[model samples]
Target: MMKNNQPEVWLRGALPDIPKLLQPAAHALLQSKEEVFKYTEDFPEALLWEKPAGRASVGFHLQHITGVLDRMLTYAEEKPLSKKQFEYLRNEGVENPEVKMDDLTHAFSEKVDEALKIFKNTPEAILTEQRGVGRKQLPSSVIGLYFHAAEHSQRHIGQMLVTISVLKP
Candidate 1:
């Protein structure tokens, strides 16, 4: 069992103590929304979800990113989810093959904004008890969860950007 103070210690292990670097990750996550719209409806030819070695289609890639956010942020909030919903959207978020970019982008942006707004508005004291994946039994902090969610999106968005380049090239 982890001691009460151990959660912060664990979080610091995966993420460095420097909160300054996190701002860029947050910016990248926000920029991903604009980039999604820019590449899809406005400019389909722009590389947004192209993958090398013949991976998921562009549409699926976009949906995959959204699905991840939905799980890491939405599900983490303890919303009721059907078994199928948990199985497909949260579990196999990346394996699907037929998501339209416009729809995925819109939904993703909404959820991302929702979670970010919560993090921005939530009180410091109340935020500590919020649960995150794998930390349910341990009672994780909301600030850590919020940052993890952003970092999670930012990392995958970076991958999507690269995949787009490969497909475009």
Candidate 2:
């Protein structure tokens, strides 16, 4: 049972109890994509499904989510991607109508799966090794990387939900 008085696990500089943490948010994130992709007889091609005119479009936001997680995982492994790679992933999806929404989701999830496997096999002492994530001096542990990966996923899922609502409005 979660105790109310326990410091919120996310804020603390501690690894979350993963067996309890990883799957639910991951599942929610994967499931929530249905908002963009939808589950109906008449769901349209992702390229043609427009969100509200003023906001970040559905594909762009989804790419941003995937890009962030992919870059973060790469950082965790000490093989951070180049800024160009980051920009390409972050911006490319929406700009091109040819990109398959299912492909994007599947590829992003595949990266997440690799990161999860890394978490399961990586020793705690090693994950705690400090590595700079960009120009910032702030340090992140392996556990923190794991936490960031999952949380980032949920955050974007929420963004997708809003986009879906706006599109339907």
| Among all candidates shown, the one with the greatest lDDT | 2
lDDT of 1 by residue, 12-49 (tens): 34322324434443454566665666445443533434
Question: Clashing residue pairs, candidate 2?
Answer: none
Alpha-carbon runs more than 4 Å astray in model 1: 1-28, 39-51, 54-57, 75-81, 90-98, 130-139
RMSD to native for every prediction?
10.9, 7.6
Q: Compared to the true structure, candidate 2 yields what TM-score?
A: 0.67
What is the clash tally of candidate 1? 1
lDDT of 2 by residue, 1-169 (tens): 1124534334344344434445443444444333334421132455334656666665666677667776777777777578787677656545676676676666666666666565556665675577657546368865566667666766776676676555642
Clashing residue pairs found in predicted model 1: 50-163
Candidate 2, superposed: residue stretches over 4 Å from native: 1-42, 46-53, 90-93
The C-alpha local distance difference test score for the whole of candidate 1 amounts to 0.55
